[model samples]
Target: MDTGFFAPLLTGYEWQLSLYAAVGIAAVTLIGKYLVLLIPAFRAEHARNAAMRRSKMTKPHYAQNQRWNRRWGPVFLIAIFVGVLPFCLTAGSQPWWQMLLDIAAILLVYDFFYYLVHRFLFHDGGLLGGPLMWVHAVHHRQHNPCRQDSSYIHPIEVALGLGLYAGTIFGLSRVLGDFHVVTVVLTWVAFSQINLHNHDLWETDRFPFRYLATMSRMHHNHHARFTGGNFATITLLYDWLFGTLDHGHGYGKTKVAIRARSDASGIKKPPAEAGG
Candidate 1:
């Protein structure tokens, strides 16, 4: 077989073009998200005060989280690429929409896996125990969750969360063919980018909350109160299906204290300021 003949076919248009587009999109998303957070540091007095307040609350923790991320994030990121590379190298060859659907499939599959894994790791103590809890516990400890410490997960926790999902995606791709790899990776990237933006306090005005409400609520509720629900990151369909949906008390301004009685009543109410 002539390998050289297939090289041009594979490298000609789809692979070269889509790969460049994805990289550019990913970079822009990262830069824009960070700028949104940093912008507040330069605004008017009240805005600067609020920004300083958030910086005080979050900057230190974020610095720490960055330390941990530098130590571990690259490892996991590399592992994910390595695990998914076999299938993804050829991902761009398909039509763009098919590529998108594949990405959606990955996002769906991983979100469910993440929900289940989080449930097991955080909620099930008998299996993994309390030490692992501390790492994750710190993330929920604050009323206003910081994006920096968001991924400061225990190394093992990161491995489990990322590795299993990547492995499962790898296994599924073996059967499903290579079409979805690029799309799946793209969707996951979109989810992560949005997740970071949602946590960024600086984006009070420009951030896209309406677009992210479904999945963002899960993390919001997770921080508001560890009510043992809202596990999915990119989609809440899993939570709604599994009965862990926390409608939260109100808009982003207030906090909602969930209770046994409240849970039993089954009445979804807007968040009250008192809870904050």
Candidate 2:
């Protein structure tokens, strides 16, 4: 009953079974994120165009997003492994719920780090200014991003995910305990999937599931202006708590833009250019 004590929560479960379960969760979550967000978001765009009897959303541009993803997706996926696998290996013998909570706390910590890295480091002329900025710019260049396009990130940024999350687990486990590491890894895997789903276009009314809707809208706006607002990857609490959320940018506007991209070439033209 010692709250301060750190120990593995699972003893009856076989190590092999635990390893398999962790891998299975990672696989299912990965596929779920891609299919749920990218596929539906893409389909929604197509449906919108078809309903309007217009074919402005060209297949080539749509495919372009896919191409970028295909070329780079594996690398990004590797980051997931780099980030979660080691931690899982070290701490897979914990209570499932404890693992889940650890994952959540890790995600929150990493998300905040992401926000800081994104806002100050990526934006400012700091260490991330040169390489990270260039890589991320490819993403920003996509004015009207497809749902799947959300996966597009500079390899540099992708690398950070691996380092920040994995490195955190390593450092924390040394101080906290081995079982806690597994918990955090599982949580991160779940979070990675959630982030993927939220970024891609898929309608949902679920448990706010990490506040996906709010975060998705914020990211959409970031794409909207090609800059600014909604920096947090996992939760809006950071932005909301830190006075960074753009309340004026209503969800209505975001929906319109999303629908419009769906109806058009799947490429979002600048608002000014669209007007002219």
Candidate 3:
């Protein structure tokens, strides 16, 4: 809760609460990814993602995205551990219910702000002589983007994107007087995985899980069809509330819709689907 929380991480409650949450989440995610691969549905979803990227010929951008992610991803991790954890986390003062409430509030607040930022600042080029569009345009290159296209953005975008997520945590810290470490960690990890899943090409019509499926479709539509819609990150609630959520972009066959969108948006259309 104090200014210098980093010193405590090595030999204090920060180690047990914060690092434990992160490490446990990482272990579960890494192990669960493999475990889930055994499920036919999940395996097919992954295969669909890979095949979609290949069919759309997104290899060059995909490889470039990977390279940039590998470079900047570690910087992001350092920021999380050194900067964010210290700024937003406390050992374990808050009650479990309060921690849950804090996490929900943080996510809802972050998503609402991100919806505005993504739509205006990033999409329409909000600052610096309108050059943000040029930077954001790189991300729009892949009309039929998949999971690989998620982080394929400029370094400037990376920095600013990090700012928004971290800003939410630090900004809330002042208002809420420091959150529990587990609360911050779970909120951040959920924030991250949701972004990755947004670009995924999977479909799940099940209850709570179906929300992501719907969100993913909307995001793909943002890339492939309606470029100016579905700008929310964590949830589409803002999009719906702000009248930007677009479900009419789906035009039966996906490839045809994407090609049509490219022609309309002036992005170079790929070759016919016969061989594409």
Model 3 lDDT tens row, 1-276: 764765555443343455665786687678767987897777888898878766554456567666887798778767766656565667756688998989888898989888776777666523433336677777777665677677777777887788777788779888987787677767866887788888887676686568767878778777763244787888878878877766644332444575687789887653322211
Residue 171, model 3: Cα distance from true site in angstroms: 1.2
- Candidate 1 overall Cα lDDT vs. reference? 0.56
By lDDT, the candidates rank as: 3, 1, 2
Q: Top model by TM-score, which number?
A: 3
Preferred candidate (TM-score higher): 1 or 3: 3
Which rank order by TM-score, best down to worst? 3, 1, 2
Model 2 over residues 94-194: C-alpha lDDT tens digits?
66776666666667777888777776666532345543566566567654443445555555666676577666655555655554434543565666655
Residue-level lDDT tens digits of model 1 in 1-276: 878876754552334434544575577667765665574432332353345445654557655654776788678866555435444445336788777766777778877887776765665423455445655665665555444435645666777776766775666567667544345546656766655644443333334544443444456656675544566666668877876665664222222344444566775553432111
Please give the CA lDDT of all the candidate structures: 0.56, 0.55, 0.71
Tell me the deviation in Å of residue 119 in model 1.
1.4
Candidate 3: misplaced stretches above 4 Å? 1-22, 51-58, 125-131, 203-209, 249-276
lDDT, candidate 3, at 84: 61
Q: Whose lDDT is higher: candidate 1's or candidate 2's?
A: 1
Would you list the clashing residue pairs of candidate 2?
A: 57-264, 57-265, 99-183, 103-187, 144-268
Report the alpha-carbon TM-score of model 3 versus the true structure.
Answer: 0.75
